[model samples]
Target: MSLLFCEVISAQQSLPKIHKDEVDFVNPLIGTAITGFAKGLDGGGTMPCVNVPFAMTNFVAQTGESKMGRMCYQYEDKAVIGLLATHQPTVWMGDYGYVSIMPQTGSLRVLPKERRLTYDHKDEIAKPYYYSVKLKADAKTSIKAEIAGANTCGMFRFTFPAAEKAHLIIQGINLNPELTDWANDYKSRLKRLKGYVHIDTVNNEITGYNPDRQSAQLGPELKNFKGYFIIKFDKQIRKYGTWDNKIIKKGSEEQFGTRMGAFISFKTLANTQIKVAVATSFISLDQARSNLKKEIPDWDFEKIVKDTRNNWQQQLKVAQVNGVTNEQKTIFYTALFHTLLFPRQFSEYGRYYSAFDDKIHNGESYNDYSLWDTFRALHPLLILTQPERINGMVKSLLQMYQEGGWMPMWPNPTYTNIMISTHADAVVADAYVKGFRGYSTKLAYDAMHKDAFEAPDGDMQKKWGDRDLWTSYEARGGLTYYHKLGFVPVDKVRESVSRTIEYGIDDYCVAQVAKSLGKTEDYNELMKWSANYKNVYNPATGFMAPKNVNGQWSAKPDSGFTEGTKWTYTFGAMQDIPGMISLMGGEKPFADKLKHNFNDGHYRADNEPGHHYIYLFNYCGMPWKAQELVRQHTGWQNFRNAPIGINGNDDCGQTSAWYIFSTMGFYPVTPASGLYSIGAPQFPYIALNLQNGNKLVIKAIDLSAQNKYVKEVRFDGQLIKNHIISHEQISHGGTLEFKMTSVPQKD
Candidate 1:
């Protein structure tokens, strides 16, 4: 390419692509090999659940503890019990809940104490959708389990040793202590276990719990899976269901275990061979069922698993970078896998519990939209391939607003109880601008406005109240002087810098949404607010230095932002990078600054804010800088095993997700806006299958540890100089090639 053409190409739009059937490109276990603090169950290093995001009822447990030091649960405990309906937060939070169910043999009792369930390594079977475990038994007892959303169905097949002392002990309540004991002193709690099944599906609600629901409705002499309960209601009638446990036991602890069948079947289905379904609302059980029946109504479990795996294959296909090692493939696909975990599926059998109202409603909605982490990348990832789900998510957000009074900031089952900044406006605005038409634009706009007007609920509200005033105060133009200048004070209030950074994002989001909707006045107002990032700039340090109420830079500048420092926080002005660049003087110095920043050991790669900063070099006419950093980070890090090995907090896989994409050679640079800028590919070959029936393929040229920097670039075999890629081009399909260099390709 000529220099002029290269200049133009660099200035013009550029994007990448993945193929439709490039299944081999996806290896959902890249980063798991070195799961550090995530060791055991905590580090979250497990096999990919080849299904919809959170589609599988359970993730497979490896043989040992995760790097986080917790032993994962196994299906083949001493006895077969029920599969739990609740779980704790995935990445950021630890195991807050450890609900377990187990069945016993020898006697019909509640197992008044805890018991040890042991299993051999060879007795377990795990696939994408199926899992089974053979407990520690001589012969005859085997427990198999699989997930179908709202329910976990387990089938136990057992043979008896013909002992007169056979019995079945049902342990109902599972606690943290119990799980710890089960992982360690398994022999200690084998006798006096005390628990029973609630036996009531109708009595179960995601939002509310009845104390009585904990007690067994069945008397002590319970037999098989025969148990029942009633749902109490005030006015609104909702679709209900039933739960039952059935197990045939024999020959007590005279060296014997029992088998059990646990199921949670929806009311819409009369078939005993149950199909598990979930809905996002109460009014649309039929719609959910229609979805289920149309998509997967037949009892072919294998087909369903295949279909689910295909779904993941297609989604992960959005950005495939090839010619990498097996470990790279695993990390890449696994990161993609983690991204799909949440906004989980709540639309069971065409009906779902609503986040807007504390009631069971029905509508064609996707319930598990966790905007907290998803708004960053998952939703954008979906928009590129699974636009259909994006439509559903948009409509769900709108309905949530209509029924609950505002768009959810951090939604749970029945409340949009706000947590964090009201960034829904950014998501809606981006979706609308991106041409996602699943929901009403006007309604969405109104919801965004409503969400902006209110304070988020809980600790978020108490921490960051009055968004407008905060923005105004911060945007007054001379932040440093205003601080030497006595505006923000330093004390126990560690929230000062964080609040500023957050307000900047909010302002940018509001501006983007307003501009998209053609509200010029609102747009102008928010644009000024968006520029509030200027207040934190420190020319001396060339970072977004924090200041005190006196308008002077904080003297004690040690980790100013919540989890990052001034240098790390400085480059986070995504909303107005040009402004940030201008603040650094010009492109040359700006590029130099970025290069310097990257090598300073200040960039927290494990944290979210610093994730895409490597790509920022491309915007500054120094794309090679991004290439070097990308390759270096991928190469230097131990992709598997180690606790502090993570660059920062997992932040629900955001950092890992970033690594997954970067190693593949691109990223959704502006997550809320659905834009992926190109970078250097760490691998020699990669491909992604987009839901839009297109593929994104990336192949590195002369790639190696020494040849990390990009020597040249091409899109679809055409020579190119531009380093950035767009969302549209990636989803549509094409190959991106990067020629490597032993030294800087400065020419």
Candidate 2:
């Protein structure tokens, strides 16, 4: 080896060093850019937002009109429209109750196109709790905008040149009179989403409300659902006006209707700084004002930044990260930051407006449950990093069941019922199995059990698109057929093959919960129902193939899946891998099939369906294959420290969750099973500080690119033969040591 290679190897063999100030390693911009797929690299589908962990609202620089399938801020975008307070969970989810604020100089520009201010990436700073940029309003005028975010409020500091017509525009998303389309495209700006605005010149404030949610068409008509915002300024408003579309009524104090907005104009000295704090609420206008007064009591932008940063520091510090290069550290912590941004806290000040019941109630609540995507890995990660909040999250789900009459598949505040099957069962079951309680297990089991047998409103022979009109709760799309025929029929259901397999996985989770509650009959029946996955398996193709209502396999065996293909779902029945392996002919054949799938470029690490596919090798006894693949994924290839880092939609943190788990050397391949599949640890040493005063340390001796596979695994100094560890072992705390070697440990 050359001298450089020798030095690198020596460094990798050195003792792992403890890393501090991990918050500084977070790069919010990692998944913000949409790039790389065409160039044979990972593409991203996430926005760079400034917010606290699980914050109700996210504050971000708005580049253009963005929501569900579009990013608000793209790295390629050359201008900034405004600073938006958004509740968009992911690129695949719609934003609800959103608004924006912008600083303007000279003539006022209120519309998104007119208000566009140019900015360069080099002049910007983006972090979880903070964002700042210098926007050129004119050739000679550059407005410096800095932002700090809290759970429900956002603080802004805008520095301006000596301009007499300096203005602050408070705007509402114009999406009320929306087009009845998936894109949420508005036909005309003249007749847009109805909004309300009030300019309090005496108090130097502006208040507004927007009652538009793009996901509303998929849920109950919420009577009192709207975002109420209270903006407090630390300066006097000399002149003010409200605007509706292109009609700018000067000196107007209040306005309510299409495309509503209010602007306050005043003279400013050279380099004069104006600070504004804004808080939002779903309860009422009074609550919005209260949130503003309570969360941000004064105009201390720096203090808020410092406190929020410190809050993030504590959260990021929970994992005592070590080993790897600084680049890996950035990717690691940034993924952590992404994972904690969803299942957002919807409750405000101990009270919340329930979108399901369409009323305000006193209790803890969390919205945007993205259960289908998150239950796979995100919630599993939360069980470790956010143990204290688990009860509240479960209670929130119970509240949804109580109020809505059913447990939603994907609760975007209410039920979008977006994804297939009921993975919410997996989340609840996994939590309970991992020793979490407080919510009634009886009710939890009932809710999950109901989904296994109970059919939805439209029953079967219905093409329930991913996001259809919310006419009724779609608990289990083809449950009627799956319950009777042991499989969902392709002729009856749109995504028959995928649903059959996923429903099987969900049923297995419900069975575990039932077994824990001592309901043997229910356990046996659910367990039997869980094996319904066999009905869809085509031994001829060695794939989970679609079958027609006539009990015959479809000609196109690979069709009818959700966001994936046959190669993705064939081994996706993670709940009963032994059964899957048996069906696939045997252990050797199963392992060969897995290798075939990976070698053929059919395994998509970019999506959730194939997320657990990487761990299937452990079952068939080729864990070194899993170890190698895990390293390639957790390393720089899939998870990058750049704008186009992640291969696809972070899916509200599932992508990041996979990285954290796989890198830490364990993955909850089958949630609710209470067992984590072992993968190769990229980090030499990782200290996980559990909430219950337990410290789990993961050590990888001599881990490097060269030492790529695990020679042997030991937990608490005992050798692990099966390449698996239980939740109890991890939660109770102990050391998990993996001896590394350059050669694959096929044995």
Candidate 3:
């Protein structure tokens, strides 16, 4: 048995029992504050979104006024433009399919800036499924608005001060006009960039269409891209009209032009409430109405909010941890909340509109993949907590391949071709290996194999193939020389080192699936190719350097690496850590280098490449070092309830997943490997409710901020001789106890 896990006395003491609801810790504002790194951008850019788990659409208050301001609802901003139904995954990528609505008591303004109202943040209420704010449009009028939504439908209730011309305006904003040539040519842009709004004064409703002109990137597969919506109001409409180009034409039922929208005015007494229900569909206007009817048949604002909260509570109940501070619980649950937001449900009812085929398909379809970011930790966390959801996600990816002829790289309601490498390979393989096989494994393997072996071609290449079918290998830009040179030459690609390392991990994933399917030749070949990351290692500089096509390292070696530095890529060889340590001259030397990297601030916790580096200490036979590093990084980089709490973009919850795993005292360094590298638990106890009708409990005795080192570890009373635990052991369910101390435990 390893001396690190030698038998030690367990401390016995009765601790305070913390219930699930007692925490009330899912603060949407925890990561909302802007930070230094994300300054002027979405600093700590987490959306204070109000939606159900995996809902197709989310409602957030739009506060910023600039073009880049669309990315964040800065807490410091004093004005509220309106509320929007947005599909904004991160501030960096911007938003799509956006529809804005504002309530006013006096004269109506067509533009967002003119109609913006000042609101106090202290009076605002934000919850998982509900958001409310009191906005003052002028000196005499104040509008209290509350919102809630489920699936493809949402509702808004507004209390208006008694006024003669109380009105509600609905507008569609052109989020991405750069995709069209209209930006350069004003006349052509105005003529081509058009939307439609039709008002029904008799039915007190408004219907419109917003076409996504950014289809140049979706290729021939996307026949048409449009979002249709139907909004019904509860109050009687005294007057209605349409607006175009900042001109309001009263009593006009229809309008078609750039910057088009509709408004409905009503006369109401003091404290009179107005309710609005809206449904959106990519299929047609009729489908949008049907969605509104099915999801929310009546004007019950409170019921929707209550139901949405219950829905979030049910999902949040999967893992319950006790004996943590209120602030710690807040951070943990908020991180978990962000992880469940993406890979959103794009399909409504039994029908889904595919950007790949430009046809409405009958089934559940999910979009907003962000695979390069989510595949690392988010998908793996879902595999453990929400296996059934993972099954659906796998099926969704395979369906995309069947429709588009290639798997998605980073899908935002369509094949975006954003980021690098086909990481859908890793997500699918990880699910299959973790025993979630509701999807077709054979079909998945075929997709993964095609992405790995096939050359860049029409609508199938790595980047921008979705938009331009004729995009060349050089234009696609990610390890294009992999087949010929066995490694991505820095001279040939932009992010050459990042491409090689990420591709190596993707290759390892495909090998796992191939081996499971009994393809011995392919498995062995891929396994060999997976080790190609070592080719980029430069022992001279002790960093992963870029090499030329002729196999010669760069003279100065570009310091401005891909999204990171050369030091970040040095530990990118995650598949072969033992070999990586050997290349650095053995365990002791590797440990010393890692220490210098962390102590000297070379190990970045802000990006994805170095996410698994802190856990690499486990592979070097120094579990104690891994424990302290986890604690230090978690403390420094993460926060409890501040807006700028997170150091970087959530990356669709990958950053949060690191926190969830590290706080739980283990992390999956190699996600699909099914092994979790052990660390020190932050809490005294954590109970995860498994889907298999079992509970996995973790207990840490004498656990405190100072006592971050693990003195001894045991699983269900048996000593854990190794610094690792398997998925089978955790999922089967049992107690894992840890003894902690201020001093490190020597092996």
Best by lDDT: 2
RMSD of each: 11.1, 2.6, 4.6
What lDDT does the true structure give each of the candidates?
0.48, 0.84, 0.76
| Model 3 C-alpha lDDT versus the unseen true structure | 0.76
What would the per-residue lDDT of candidate 3 be over residues 1-747, giving only the tens digit for each residue? 211121111112222254456225788876676553443333556778888988888887878632322354777788887777777677544355567788987777867778889998887988888889999967866899888988788998889888887888888645333433311122433555567878886787888877633322332323467778888888777688888767899999888776668888888789999898888888899999888888898988889888888889888888887665555667788888988888888888888888777788988788878787788788888877787788888888998888878887866666654567888998998887888888788899999998787756542234332223323322224444776677777665557777778888888888998998999999998888788888888888888888877899977586316677888888887777888899999999898888888889777677777888888888887888998887777773455567777877787788898888888888887856878888988778888888868888989998765677999899999898788899889889999899999898767
| Regions of candidate 3 where Cα sits further than 4 Å from its true position | 1-23, 37-42, 65-72, 175-193, 213-221, 458-480
Quality of model 1 by C-alpha lDDT: 0.48
Please, what are the lDDT tens digits per residue for candidate 1 over residues 434-465? 77766787787777665443333332222232
lDDT of 2 at 428: 90
**Candidate order by lDDT, highest to lowest?**
2, 3, 1
lDDT accuracy of residue 239 in candidate 2: 86
**Model 2, range 219-258, lDDT digits (tens) per residue?**
6767678899888888888788988878898999999876
- CA lDDT, candidate 2, residue 507: 89
Error of 2 at 201 (Å): 1.3
